[model samples]
Target: MRTLLVSLLSISCLHAIDHGPYIQWFQDPCHEAEIRWVDRSGFQAKEGEWSRGRGGFGYGDNDDQTVLNGMQNKYTIVSIRKKITLAAPANADDELIVEALYDDGFVLYIDGKEVLRKNSTGADAELEAPGGHEAKAWEKFSLGKIASSLKTGSIVAMQGVNDKLDSSDFSLDIRLSIKGKTSTDLITRSDSWEYLVNQIPEKDWRTSTSLPDAVPWKADAQYTLGYRPVGNGEMTWTSANSHLFARTESKVFSVSLKGLKADTRYEFSIRNESTKEISGPHLMQTAPETFRPMHFVIGGDMFHTLPLLDAMNIRCGQEAPLFAALIGDHAYTNNGNPDRWYQWIDSWVTHCRAKDGRLIPMVMGIGNHEVAGGGFFPENNTPTPDKADEFYTLFRMSSEGSRVISRYAVDFGNYLSFILLDSGHTEAISRQVPFLAQSSANRKKTPFLFAAYHRPAWGSGCKDDAVDIQQKWCPIFEKNGVDAVFEHDHHTYKRTWPLTAGKRDDANGIPYLGDGAWGVAVRNPSKAELQKRPWIAKQAPINHLIRVTLAKDGFTCDALTADGKTFDSGTYPLRK
Candidate 1:
């Protein structure tokens, strides 16, 4: 079968079909790109010691294929050159397509003439100095019809510049193609995203792989995230929501698609309006207007090793749940590092798709690791939004804005509610009391009201009971009759007997589940520790996620391990 598959692929490559509405000439898919790179100080006009490697050259970020060591604190620029051998070339009507991922900035040259640049400044004849912009996402540029410059064979060169020699990280990657009329659409899972030239001028036309920065109070584009919904033969472009990342000033934005029939599947693609880059033909489903059986997976300590997280994510995807509630410690960026967030988000998008290809919506909460400096603060100083900038920015918590406050509540019609809390990560635990009290009160009639936060109030694996949570929030949870509370941060699996006022109350108390072992290394509470905590009903040392199925009168919880094996299960009646 393997041999037959290889043979079939080879045969398909031999015969090219005219896939046109627009003319396109892509680099040979099988060709290994020959890239040479060297530091600026070591560069010699055309003769210098250069190292041979593929594209993506830099260090400090995980994206690099060729790691440039010692580049930090020594030089701010690296010279990169690639030899391109086109199958055919030299057409005035053909535009040379250029896509680059660069930190600081860079200038692209073909046959020693400057064709494009970004975050860089210098004359055409000399290397451009670095600009101060950190790399956001891949930037796309269409160098219109390079017939006079590009021939059958040309040397492509770039000076990958860094914002500063002392910068923490640097990277540069380049992709080249040729297209007539316009470049090929950025193909995503569900659609072919074509670029429309008239939207922006060719020379000044630059688009990001991610959404552009949010436009302030613009009617059509109000958010940091932007999208153009492609359907039938027309495109409706709109943008909504905005949450700012303090470090890069990049906002996470969204575009809303409203007035959909309940329980119906819809397809849409995400596109950057400015750069004309598009991704997705992703799937989504609306909730039924009437009550129905549904389930959602919840977990925390979400990111550890990539393989472990991916395995668990893939399993969760297999469940085809309506959504996922990642309580906290997501990405474990630890210090709000943008690169780590990039990796984590990419992984989730890639692995968390349901078998039917639906993109699972995420409900998030703040945790200790989400904040820089380990989520601890002096008694008088409460943790603030700026401290957990990445978390607030990457995930929009409310229409008010991610930076407004970490605690918020979301309802699924009138059947279910999720109260996401800060748990001392971004806001004081005591400060959350009033908010929690009111949030729980508003959801008193909700059939399945649940609370999720990072720290545990009745922890099984750790000694500290998160006293503040017990004192300030527990009373509110019990008073308002929250059905259950999800707790994380201890890295162990736990389920507690229903407790109303710090003591188990089988009939009226709120049951607490989870010690947040998601993708992190799991811990086993010693026999002594379990014995000391009488409220504990069950415990395990395993990476698992909780799949909660909500019914009309009750919900069922199943704890599945990393490989999707059900190790524990229980059913709880909805609190009256």
Candidate 2:
């Protein structure tokens, strides 16, 4: 029987007072409330005048001041009745975040004592004040520590005390969320492995015919680790820094398998030594020298938007793939501000968890939009200065210097390999040519070789016709026997035939998929352009996502549109 899980928010369990009748709630639980004084006569604060606080609340905007008033005999708390429940975690390291909005000054008490205090009343008062108000609201506060204090079924309460002299429309909004341990919650099963191709001697593993640069062998390079539980025993394998070429250096990285029972469920994760952030405890089942049919999802260019996120969630629910490859443009950065990236990841953390409450293992690629001006031109290019900086900081991607630009690859068991490439802001494609060539040669054992980058080699929406792909990257792709290429940019869907240099379709050419319709929109591809390109096989004007299934016969690809239509479908046979 298949298990079904649904995530729901019960507001009554989150707060002590019920303010639902007076204030409107925002979709993002993290945001502060937009209080409108519904009482008509305004709020009467007798205790003291409501003033601003120091840090305000914990919301993103620091300019919003929190309401503050001292306890006085004249003050009567105009109660905004709301109840907040504390999130109890199954594990110890779990974190809970909370945000509240108020007019004037306010204090947070756990069991009737001050845990957090805010008073934005001085010259700094203007800085903490929320935008647009005679009396601004407090900034949203983040209470990771508070989450740690919660007992499973504890009552979390909040009181919005108001001063007597100050009277205006009073209201408050509250949000509570919990994040569990990052790497300790995955399901793993163990199986014994059998070698497929032993033509190359075991001692000569470094000289094998796999793509050379595809595997990084640097001693300092990061690695992914996990344990497979089989009954009463567990098997741990720290992924070897498999080099794409024999000439590449070797690196030492290992995964730990612990406390796992043989043939039992366990979890695994990728740890980046450089950043100390864990990738996942994503689920995987192991079989002894046998194949377990696997499924996964791939798509990119998701700008922060609720409707698109909702659609993606629905699609994932329907497909129920084991993993998702977010091939770049996961978030849009306007003017290359890094704060936007933080917001984007935070948004994902709040919404993108799986039905089982497991964080999906995301294989991320860099998109043009992630860079400074969202393009490849030198004028538009401004590499993020720190390697393992903001963006990479959150998702443990390898970095060269301060820039998160590096060639990386991941093997799905022994059948397929995903080569994630960076194509924005930093160095041109020419710089990574060596790595690309090495990646192609390493695919002999892995029948399926998929590559993804930011911009497309061929697309219809833009009249330029994927100039960058044509000029700089096509040769590299053709030189290496890459199977399919995933590209994002146009905010509309388009797929191309396997073609060689220029545009002639070739039976042996590599197929190109995508023009990134994840969350943004653009003008439809013109009929003239569509007709002009014979290699163009499919197109969709709506937001859509791609699902790829790998099997023994070959591979199947389907494009599912936002409205739940399968706009395109095709099968690519394995190389003979």
Candidate that scores best on TM-score:
1
Query: Stretches of candidate 1 above 4 Å error?
Result: 1-77, 80-235, 240-244, 249-253, 258-260, 399-403
Give lDDT tens digits, candidate 2, residues 481-563: 67788887777877777778756555778788877777665448678777777878777776878888877877878888756
Model 2 residue 240 distance off true place after TM-score fit, in angstroms:
22
Q: Weakest 10 consecutive residues, lDDT, candidate 2? A: 35-44
Instruction: Please estimate how well model 2 matches the true structure, expressed as its whole-model Cα lDDT.
Output: 0.48
Per-candidate local distance difference test: 0.64, 0.48
Any idea how many clashes model 1 has?
4
Residue ranges of candidate 2 with Cα displaced over 4 Å: 1-291, 335-343, 346-358, 379-388, 400-404, 502-506
Backbone clashes in candidate 2 total: 81
Model 1 error, position 329 (Å): 0.3
Model 2 Cα RMSD, Å? 21.5
TM-score of each: 0.63, 0.56
